[model samples]
Target: MKNASAINGYEMFVIQMLFSGAAAGFIYPTFLIRSTEGAYWIPIAVWIAGALLSSWLYSRMLARLEDNKLIVVIRSSLGTIWASILCLPALLFLFGALIVMLRAYSEIITMTMLPTTPISFLNGMLLAPASLALAGMMPIVRAARVFFLLALTCTLALLILGFSDIDWTLGTPLLRTNGDFLLDKHFYAGSFLWMGFTITSLIGSYRMQSARRAWKSYVIALFCALPFIAGYVYLPIMTFGRELSQRLTFPFVSKMDSIYHYWVVFENMTAIFVSVTMLYVLLIMALQLHALGETIKSLMPRAKTGLIYVIIFIVVYSVATYLSSWRAVEQIVFITVGIRLYMMFVFPLLGMAVLAFAQRRGGKGNEI
Candidate 1:
């Protein structure tokens, strides 16, 4: 493990800690979007429920294993080969998620922001930033903190503006006429992104400080997440209602276009919002990419971590870029993230149990 200079002060760590949670939350909107195969909130509602379950497991992991990282906890308690094997789903999901996010964001940028720019060139633009982020995990995390704030601002701006352009009458239809198609698809696929919160549980805490302000960090996490849910799901439901929100490709931006501030100089505010959103999503993707890359590198010290990270970014994003159809991408998300989240729930719970046993065996003198 890199000698982590523990981020000091509970409050500072509290702020930093919550960013992950917030970052996790931001992915939900994208998750809901990609997973939005049927109905309105069914999948999302399931996702939120699963997320809360993950949160419960997270606290268990934190409480029982005071010192070990998630990878170590898994390898030691679950057996290295088995744990590593289990990690495949997460690795694939992480890689796929990052790839898909980049492509989707680039697509969003192309569609909304840089209409004239070719996707190939726009995708290439992500390299430097992604590389720079992967090169230094801490710095990327720090950058994420800033980006999280910016993303939040943009989301709020979206809510304020969404009301302007969106036709409120769209909410009129039955929320979901179904008992069947909605149940089968929306409940199953739509909530894939809410699994983003699992990052906090899976990656383990990097910048550990005194556990004094843990509650504060938890509070911050909840605070960060609620607004994100609001932005991705709540705002859309409010603005476009059940009928139109499911139809819109980029519902957030679509809502943004409805409201206009004639005095505002920018011709397309959706473009600006998307760019800001992309930056935030990029920060998150970089962090997850770095975390997994770092963990694997820690296990294999001889490898150049930077090169590995770059390779990973390229490979995943390339596949994402290749995903030509929206449906294909959505289905992939269901399989990948759904599988990752299943492991997230299982291994973390197992780790917590084993750590608790280990702690009892050691008589609590040392948690590591």
Candidate 2:
């Protein structure tokens, strides 16, 4: 593991921003719109609240452990047997997320940019992530830092340009929908969008300087992403109305398509939006793959990092290829929502318990 000093607060912020930004785009807006209808903002609010709470819980655990990696702390508090057992779900969660994201992005690319190209050809894009993961952590962090400015600029520009079509009245009577919708299974299912702050937990130990900075970075990143997320969800509904927006698969992209730019070089702004978003998604997949490799190394100390990444690449590629159609991929995405919720809530509680156990045992020197 690299020293915490190697990673500064700004880099940490950029990493969180990249992950959260990518997640905020794409299918998340669709899930939020479909689940909440007119009351879509309600779930967005709930998601933000849930994310703050989760980040707080994780920050507390990090502080108590004196900045040790979560996997190490888990093993120390619970014996290797129990720690390995707990890690099983986490491993599954990471891999499941990887598969779902890979399939989702590929499906979108096949529909948008490469309609005539074979799905397999589009899936080859996984090689980018595979190469990044194999290169190790520093390269990924550097890439995030380098691209963060351009990506944020373009995204904000797109959002600003999109405001011309907004109709404030479309989101009226925000909570008029049936209250039961808030408690529905799909409501919490969409929490993954905001709950992406949890990505900090996976990579936090690497370049984390202090728990306070980490927490602040997370909070700031969430706020930074708020406008874009809101624009992604509400802009579509405001432009197309809730009824029509709900029916469309990718309403935000569709919203972009509806905009015509006569003075611009590219006739379809959705193409530009897709291109920018694709860069962010590639970073996300690479980060997930790196997290999977770290998880495996924690369990088997002797595992070769290269071999671990190769195995992950093969598994993800094979599964994504097998689930060839949109319906199959959608099912996988819905199924993993439950898994994501489990990890979001359970892991933090487990961390608190582990911290308490360690404290009772007078294990103050447990810092990794």
Candidate 3:
């Protein structure tokens, strides 16, 4: 690993791109399509506004830390006991994301390309990311850069191809909503799509960077992903009416299979979609594992970090493999909805409050 300062806003941007891309493929659209009867974009718009607000608070919290780890900064602001209590939910959030991601992607593979492949074997995909996570953040960033290029090119081509066979009339009621999604649990479950800012905060602070710059990078990355996210949900709805689109598990993949072009080189568009999304999923999984490792190290400075990474890999992989069905993956995500909401909205506010209190009391206030 290199100095944490070596990580810059652009590197963070690329990583966020991967996180957003993976969500576009896996769970985000399913939840959105099911949660609303009117305009799907309304729920998306609401979530984006929520994400931007939470990200602003997080950047403010990071600004006060300079080059300190978030947990370490909180410990300096508050006592060890209070810091640990505040940080535990974040740790659980990371672990829950890992479980849901690993299981969900494996289930996707089974449903798409490799129907005969065993779930346990497909779940072994975590080993690659776990190894990279142990190697440290720089490697993951470098890998994200490479994967982002390939994944972006492939993804853009597919999105273009998806426009070939759509009936615009089927998409009537393009922009109608009565705010029904506000009461849906699936709407809350979709918060995972907007969690890139929160996840990257675990990497500690960048050297000499302003909070505004970090926040802007995330904002840009997320907005750039709007087409991909919107296309994933709406493209399928336009192709197959909402009723049929809601029934399919991987709607975009089904949309891809529906695309038939005489000039196109590929025989199977579904395979292309699955393969490209795999790159995004694997890289983001590595990012999550790295975040989890860093959080545990901050909490227990004396523990062997390598051993900690191994234990995390083993535990997450085992649980993900043993999940009985795809329904279980969604259930776990639904169960963790409260924790995700806390991390998104409450955690940053609490961190900022503690820092302000410590500075007022003249305790480690001048360190930054």
Top lDDT prediction, candidate number: 3
Q: Would you estimate the TM-scores of all the predictions?
A: 0.77, 0.92, 0.95
Output the number of the TM-score-best candidate: 3
Candidate 3, residues 1-104, lDDT tens digits: the string is: 56454566788789888999988786788888889898888889899999999998898888877677888778776767788899999988999999998888
Q: Which RMSD values do the candidates have, in order?
A: 4.8, 2.8, 2.0
The per-model lDDT (C-alpha) reads 0.57, 0.76, 0.86
> How much is 208 displaced in model 3, in angstroms?
6.8
Query: Candidate 3 — which residues are off by over 4 angstroms?
Result: 206-210, 363-368
lDDT of 1 at 146: 64
Which residue pairs in candidate 1 have backbone atoms (N, alpha carbon, C) closer than 3 angstroms, thus clashing?
164-258, 164-259, 165-258, 165-259
lDDT against true structure, model 3:
0.86
Of the pair 2 and 3, which is ahead by TM-score?
3
- Over the stretch 90-121, how does candidate 1's per-residue lDDT look in tens digits? 67666766666667667767666678886667
RMSD of 2: 2.8
Q: Using lDDT, rank the candidates from best to worst.
A: 3, 2, 1
* Number of colliding residue pairs in each model: 4, 0, 0
lDDT of 1: 0.57
